[model samples]
Target chain A: MGAGVTVDRLAELLVSHFGAPADRVAGGVTFEELEFDSLALVELAMVAQKEFGVEVDEQEFTPEQSVAGAARLIDSRRAAS
Target chain B: MPQAMPGFGVAVTGLGLVTPAGIGVDEVWRRVLSGEPTAAPDPALEGMPVDFSCRVPGFDPDRELGRRAAWRLDRSSQLAVVALREALRDSGLDPSTWDGARVGVVIGTALGGVQTYEAQQRELDSSGVGAVSPLLVPMSAPNMVAGYLAMECGASGPNLVTATACASGATAIGTARELLRGGRCDVVITGGVDAPITRTMIAGFTRMGALSRRTSDPRAASRPFDTARDGFVAGEGAAVLVLERNHDARVRGARVHGLISGYGASADAHHATTPDPSGAAAERAVRSALEDAGLSAHDVDHVNAHGTSTKLNDVTEARLVRGVFGDGVAVTSTKGVTGHALGAAGAIEAVCTLLALRDDVVPPTANLDSLDPEVEVDVVAKEPRPGRLRAAVSNSFGFGGQNAVLVVTRS
Candidate 1:
């Protein structure tokens, strides 16, 4: 798989960034379900970078709509690197 | 291509103001026209050399803006958001039907997010670097004001901020006016905000000889054009205006306040803090604004002067008003009442100018008991003066020798 990325790993990172219940941060969960906004997405990006050692291309990825979308963005960036 | 007309007019449909005088536009107008002092002793600065500063008293952020937003934003941004909400409501442009992609935002702030930066620094100094808020960079940047507006308004066209010290507000308005004239956007929210009554700023202005030291009598300290005037009083506030094409406002049957007919911007290249004593660049700013409005000196009847109570600013601005509009024009400086609001001064004065043109009354310069012997301009004093206002000018001169003058006409 690209960057050896997995949903389980990305979901764990999301739990800490949003302070959400660990079980709720799953591949199918959306950012809106936890009420994350643009600022939260920014913080998420920072946490993703530290956790996965990936460089996010903002132009290629905007996770304002969903958490699954954000996880995919992080994995793609990790794969690209 | 042919030479286009200088005064490409735009309609001012809505205004939102939060000043030391009051909260809304009507409240400020009534208090301003009736001649009340807004400056008072700020308890926060009780022990400082200059204990008096004009603050927007009783402004409840959590009540006005919801909890999460109010907590995340800096003080300046909170003030701007409240003002913007009012402006949008007053404009009556239903966002559901409006074209968000075509709308633009151009808000101005001098030291944006300084409050956030200072708080984070204190935490870092005490706790550790890790104690600093992760939101520090995104929250403290000056561009964040515009960025937040873009996010809130869903506006995509030319969202930006201008920072030229005190002229930031007027310059932002001028730039927005051009954006509309150039057909870059159909509508724009333009203005400035500043909540800079901090201890560091107070000490800095005092050390630089820019703030009034008359702490014993705060109300009477900001006496523009008075012989006893020493320095400008620091104030905090925000003002925003909704600008649209004249044709669009009429088609929508929106209430039109006045028309922005002209805007002139120039640099003195003389000094950083002090204005050019010769008043050459300042005069040029006035001439250019009048010319851009396609108006002659004789046609102008009212003026909203940037009459900060400082000795140099008052003298220089008075001379230029006399030289450009003549000594007969009714000149008033609301700063005498609301104090100098820095970047927000010009925007607040612009709102006052539109109100004056619409209401046919000129608000008086508070605390101006005795005009300086050397000054010759007709300073409106004590109470409101009513007349047929044909055209008017609002002047804003800031540090870095930046000057911007705006011309408003009754349409």
Candidate 2:
């Protein structure tokens, strides 16, 4: 966990991990809006674990959540650590 | 209305394989004959819920097929392409000369693109649907293996995929054999490919308690028909065989590996996952295969058992083997060495058994330290046994009570 992680970095990581476009994962874009299925979510979690050294439990997140919301949660966890 | 007898028999002209043992049919056969076990404790899976798995070693599809092509294909499809290419090469079937509509492709897979699906799930959870790749749906589909193979080899008669859990591979071959026998296709590339060794699949199996937990002794973990066996070790690989009508093969002057004498498929309809403990369904499947071959159980010289290494499967299969082949048949479960390749297990073992007939040897069942007392059949263990194998029967039983048996003999 680190404070240096930016929204841009998060978007890039999402694109790199999911093979999606960065603009499609913007602040207001929800998981469902982007058509992110369960399989895509798991890939995102694995990439997050590898890159950010954080484990994102599948039970904690939902399709209703926005990409910005997930980034904020990761940022807050980084701050707490 | 009476159906006319089948026109022609299916002959295996060439074979290909990509397994934990090695790549290509020759390499896989050599390793099987040497009694080698490919199960190993992977530290990458150390903290994971599933402790043991039979992973293909040093298989980098990108290195083999280039990055762009590898990216488009799942691990299972990659394995299938490699195997299919080898089989086509071995058969000397010039794709340029063959009639695409007269050739067929059938592939069986228990879990296809599971790894890709899992990866996509991670993306969906973190980002959203926009992150999902357009190729996700096609790549994750089980039939895509056959689709890819058909496209690669120009097989257009019947492109099909069978997904009967573990029996999928054998069922695929059986379907292809029927297609050939009915005079629907002259050549059919048929087999099984599975790469279900994903984190989620392992976790699910771990939760189900269907995987071995002996992480320290990987080689000794998968002891099929042995008293110490607990459960099967998950494996990933692919095996494909080129089947042609005997007349077509003769006309082409192709070297015939063996004849697919008969195939019998049955369903227990009793359970979704666990097999029928009575062994009636499995016995019927074996007997039907023998009958279809116009041979009795006595005609069978070697048996390639399903042998999942699970306690219940071992007992039920042993009873079925005894009921079919009696006490004297030389039987071996190659899953002891190859582990269970899920959908690909039966097809790969079928090919192995075919090779045993071709080479006149019984491939040994590795890691069987002590025979389960309840298993009345003769289980080949340790070193490969020399034998005059004329006709061999391979059994593949899967979840949802699906059972398939294939009888193959020397040409």
Candidate 3:
């Protein structure tokens, strides 16, 4: 599941889940720009868990953080495991 | 005991309600007093497993707010925004005159945007992410109501959303009171809104056996405190109240409808979905509210009960009411008409209680032909009960054993 989920797919999921425009949701966009509140972050984590089989902790995600950071973290975790 | 803070009383200056009973405060009161059950098998929910739901009548938020804005918001958020707009307008507080930093918004919701989430999920599953709407994420979060209200009203203070199930609304109002009492805000728009009558939500509640199966007779389905009651009917709505500090209201020459004198909240830490039959925690919540108001059981003349019409909730809430106000005080469950509004129940019931205090009339618990023998409270039924109501208590007990009680009195 980890190998199957790429940065582009994560970006797509972010765009879909956060309802942000796809162009604005690339690796550079912050969660705050997408209006991702705590509840949405929790739901996004659930979606990530269901789609990628990777349980993402909501607390670990920062609103100021970009999608690329999440992708890098997921990739690093997958490689380490 | 610690000395009571000076200028701590918070008065509800304006109220806005969007319920199955009706939209706006007066309309809701009118329908509630008429004892008309608004529960009906929604055609929108035809394919869903749960048959009966209490949907708001003629609710077109776009009529009040613009269509483009309504399109981006979920029903829950739309309800909150519209209700808050009415509440602010009723309060006569021009947002332009107030410091945005001193105004706050707190809204409570139970399931957030289950409908929007479900719709987006269907799209994601069927047509992939490209088919999902752009507003799906912002519209689905529970806190979006609070965020939207704050943005709409230009409130910059501590904006929050409480999700304590049914108690969420009362809790939101209680939080507003604290914020005003602490001098953090001069005015706070607080309440609860929920639009959870979605196919997935109805199916979930039905699967859990929490919804009434009396689809043929929706009006007779939600019989709170009645012996024939099976389970609660799902309802969608929101209620908002504008709360200001007593001194601030007086300074601004605002009409104070009623004072939110006290609020008490407690968690049973019991079952997630069932209440403690002993009703110990709920009793504590009621007692604590009374104590906070510097009153006794004798002072409360009316009670807005959290009678969900479920077998356990009705019995347990009745026992708690008896324990707090004794069998003498008049008790009524608005859910009999509103059909268990989940998270918005407390706030909507609180508004009803405030109106009852204002009008000196208690709305009846509709459809209660025969009272449950296990519940001994004086359940007001059939018609509105006229009385000299000075102080009224509204109880909201949610799932997760969360209990909140609010005491409102004539200003």
Candidate 4:
């Protein structure tokens, strides 16, 4: 909430940038469930950094993290900075 | 002459092209027949010694391929993917239902992902290592185009990339034919792609004096075999062909566009960038191809010469053709229209040869108002030539002394 990095926005980003199916991108959907490989996750992290202006360690962002979880992590990182 | 070479041919079922002339096979063929040059002022090559180049116009990769997929691939691979889609679609083969293991993919590229490599190197230099994408290796490697096509179509059989510099495309097709003749695969998605219009590649070619410096009139730059020809114009594009054994194609009821009756590949062991002045190795390749087809040179109605518009290549290739075909065969260099696509040139020309065979018309070489006096061949120029083009030879000679020739016959 601090950075306004909502789960909906994250989902939209995933769909747009990762070519994830629009219907498959949801708040509860995990990165693993979306078939985001390690490379894809790293790319997502870089994209997130560029779009959200937050420094999120790519390694810390695991495939098991859900869309909502990623939004929360981004919010926390934004707040910390 | 030998009656017919047993088991030395493969059926070309479908073709796709994204060249400077246009996208798709029909569009490019139309432009090539019209003898319109595709070279123009390239903003990317601005301030360089040879500033103009032939680029694939209206190629919005993000729109053609989904943004996500396009973002992950280099422009070279993107061109391959787009061309592969068209080829597969035209073949009436559905990858979703096909046996993936029975399919193969072979791609050829001289400078793979050079644009991507240059850009990523700049990023690393300016923003440090962390700014570089993890996809750099996958995007820049020469083998990745084959890998990408395999992934796209779920092809699991014998996938590899052939690099014979400018002859890479013909080499790929030749290799794919072997796979089929060897019973390794039922079908193969094979061809070449190169996006070499980047600043670094152009600068390198400029330094080598391998490119035409026709800054005043870019469109008239790629005049293969013309008396005024200097050097080749740099171009970027891709071409993919779906190949299968003739029997397999017939059994599956697939339309056979043409047959690759013979393929001959050789190396001069001569020089890195210069062809042998005598053109002996090139002649050997052509002779070998004709021998493999179990036919003599007289059977070849047309010669798709490797006329790169350069003084050396045009004269060498023209002499080779004259010695073999004796000025009786029709000769044309579609490179005049599409420019020199480097690795992709062979594949593009192969497709053009097939189209010419299919339509019984030889496309004219663009801007060849006056043939070079040293060139003693019947070079088709100005307008398309209509004839019984039952068979043709598509020649591709690359740097590093690589030579590959394919004898294509009408289906």
Index of the highest-TM-score prediction: 4
Give the CA lDDT, 0 to 100, for residue A39 in model 4. Answer: 93
Full-model lDDT, candidate 4: 0.91
Can you write out model 4's per-residue Cα lDDT over A1-81, one digit (the tens) per residue?
Answer: 642446778888898888898988887889999888999888888888888888888796788998888999988888789
- Model-by-model DockQ, in order: 0.10, 0.04, 0.03, 0.60
Ranking by DockQ: 4, 1, 2, 3
Clashing pairs in model 4, backbone N/Cα/C closer than 3 A: none
Error of 3 at A4 (Å): 43
What lDDT tens digits, residue by residue, belong to model 3 across residues B346-366?
999999999999999999999
Runs of candidate 1 exceeding 4 Å displacement: A1-32, A37-81, B1-4
Root mean square deviation (Cα) for candidate 1: 7.2
Alpha-carbon shift of residue B224 in model 2 (angstroms): 0.6
Candidate 3 local Cα displacement, residue B120, angstroms: 0.4
Candidate 2 has a DockQ of 0.04
| lDDT (Cα, 0-100) at B9 in candidate 4 | 76
Q: B228 in model 3: Cα distance from truth in Å?
A: 0.3
Error of 2 at B95 (Å): 0.7
Correct interface contacts retained, every candidate: 0.13, 0.00, 0.00, 0.57
Taking all chains together, each candidate's TM-score versus the true structure is: 0.85, 0.83, 0.83, 0.96
lDDT of 4 by residue, B1-411 (tens): 122354377899989999999989999999999999999999887788788999998999988998768989999999999999999999988899999999999988999998889998998999777678889999999999999999998998889999999999999998898888878888999999999988888888888989998899999999999999889999999999999888888999999999998988889889988899999999999998888887798888999999999989989888889999998899999999999999999999999999999999999999999999999999999999999987899999999999999999988
The predicted structure with the larger DockQ, 1 or 4, is: 4
- Lowest summed lDDT over 10 consecutive residues: which window, candidate 2 chain B? B1-10
